[model samples]
Target: MQGQNGRGTDMPPAVSVRLEVIKRRSDFLKAARAQRRGMPGFLLQARRRASDEPDPSAIRVGFTCSRKVGNAVTRNRAKRRLRALAREILPQLGRPGWDYVLVGRPGATVTRDFAAMREDLIRALRRIHESPQ
Candidate 1:
């Protein structure tokens, strides 16, 4: 079977990425107050964890979609896309000891082309890292 890139799909890649997700609402709220970068498809919230925080070497991430995004199905779809974007980009680009959040837009998050969204995420991350605190 051919994959999306027209490659064979007999076996999966050997890479195993361990992604740590932020679960508590407090963590999300904390990220909300931190630096944010807006893109065509979504908003990125990121901050470095304090020295006293646990898992200093881990890259943690979170995803959120508000009711304005849509109903339950639409919101879930947006979150899923954000998760995919984070998984693909964060492992390589994310800074250790930082907590990152991906917030979905009303129309853009659900309707935007995925490749464009991927590029937006990459740019957003770069902006977040390069700008002063």
Candidate 2:
């Protein structure tokens, strides 16, 4: 059967498969001060948005790679990798009302196996959710 987005799928309708992109520097900084889980390929930072905040029912995400990671080309490449991974994983595992930031690490993010990076994100999400606020 075809889903709303025009892809064939067997998944239930009760599950949300959409993620909102975070574009503001302030939002990224806010999540940065919340919680972080480090993996070899990347770092995951997540924070719960206030109940009164807009679009509290959507999962928001931001991606970034610092100059330390490399020059413009490398940093953009790393961010592209991160964006792809987030698109694949976040819709399924991400919690609503939360903002997540994925920071790419030099060398590792560009070269590590994709499967490992997926696992890292999953594990990081689990840890972040289970930790006390």
Candidate 3:
């Protein structure tokens, strides 16, 4: 099948990433604070920056897994899973004006189902954006 650019569907979609996903620091602190929300499977935190702030158009995700999750190897595994999940969902679910930080929990997060983790993140973000404080 052909795509918008007349490219083959076998080719990946040209992702339209926004700077809000990548910018590390900025002045939209209120937006970030307002957007911070959490769920059972994961913790979600966000910070908003100025609308005109210059930022790279790529998704920048921060993952944190403490000793509670496991040793180095377990932490790394959990992080990798989170990263994969973020890559799949961020482009579609993430807001262009916020930064997200996902913190990993201990037992459940370490052995939790992979697909469930992805869905949790997506659901969490959707709720955050949908609610107005």
Candidate 4:
């Protein structure tokens, strides 16, 4: 499926549009813990390094897929899909000074609807943004 980017309907390569903001060592863990504190459907996880502090201006993101998801190829495909979802929806729901991490579920992310995946990420981000600070 395609997202409305105004002017016209466009399909940017998920890789081309994806922004890679590395997570620091400590911050990653903090958010992971924050996941437990999150309300329904807003848990967080880490896909990269953890930092001492969260980045004030970057929306840190991560991707993951367990062995159950599939073989290497399937895992990669799931990651690519999540990366694309983040690319399109992150900037919209993300706050200027927040971080985002995308964690993949075995079959949930890999076999799910791409459009629904897009909506899920959007809803998650919205929950994060609307959550208490």
Candidate 5:
């Protein structure tokens, strides 16, 4: 199949790329207090784990959508979009030993275009990495 860029050979394979999931509430809260970059669709919170932490080579991430986003169905939809965005962009661009939380924004998270949402995530990650701590 041809890629979105219209280059048949330029498309990447469907190989699964694995990334560690941040499941604990404390981890997400820690990342929340770290550096954050806000985009149109979501807020990207990133925290670089200390050298002494276990799994120093793993990149971990979390997804969340608040009630302000909508009802359960809408919030879940927003989280799903954020998850897809992370899956597509984080493996290559996210730095190891860092935890990232993608928090969905009200209205924008569900209404924004998918390609634009992807770009928002990419830009937010870039800003987070480039900014001085």
Candidate 6:
């Protein structure tokens, strides 16, 4: 049997971990001051939520692309790519009660190979976790 896009109907859909999007400007600022891991394709900023914060069980994430990345279309495309990368990687590697921000690089994020970007994420996460908090 064929599924929606011609894939086999028997194949189960991808299971992604629950995540909350960070919307407040303050939250992004907080992450900006917290731990950061720089990769070739993106910069990851992560911060552990304080005990006083709400949604202690939620994993929060945000995406941003500056004008330096390019025009509206280019920035949007970069954010989209960052979102896709986060969706695929964060579920398994992300820590609960933490916020993550993926900052798009000017030339790398939009042009880097996806597999290379994935590798970059893996390494970045490892470094972030290994560093002193």
* lDDT (10s digit) by residue, model 1, range 9-106: 22234235567999999999999999999998999999999989998989999999999999999999999999998887787678889999999999
Candidate 5 structure lDDT:
0.86
Looking at model 1, the pairs that clash are none
Residue 94's lDDT within candidate 1 is: 86
For model 5, give the 10-residue run with minimal summed lDDT: 6-15
Model 6 residue 69 lDDT score: 98
For model 6, residues 1-26, the per-residue Cα lDDT tens digits are 56553433322354567878999999
List model 3 lDDT by residue over 12-40, tens digit each. 45466642333344333333465666666
- For model 2, the superposed segments whose C-alpha errors exceed 4 Å read 1-16
TM-score of each prediction = 0.87, 0.87, 0.70, 0.67, 0.87, 0.87
Name the regions of candidate 5 deviating beyond 4 angstroms: 1-17
lDDT comparison, 3 vs 5, better candidate: 5
Per-residue error (Å), model 4, residue 8: 11
Assess each prediction's global lDDT (C-alpha) against the native: 0.87, 0.88, 0.64, 0.57, 0.86, 0.86
Clashes of each: 0, 0, 5, 12, 0, 0
TM accuracy, model 3: 0.70
- Please tell me which model should have the higher TM-score, number 3 or number 5: 5
TM-score of 2: 0.87
Error of 5 at 77 (Å): 0.5
Ranking by lDDT: 2, 1, 5, 6, 3, 4
- Candidate 1: RMSD over Cα atoms? 4.8
Residue-level lDDT of model 2, residues 1-133, one tens digit each, is 5756443333233454688999999999999999999999999999999998999889999999998899999999999999998887788778899999999998998889987897788789889999998
Error of 5 at 79 (Å): 0.7
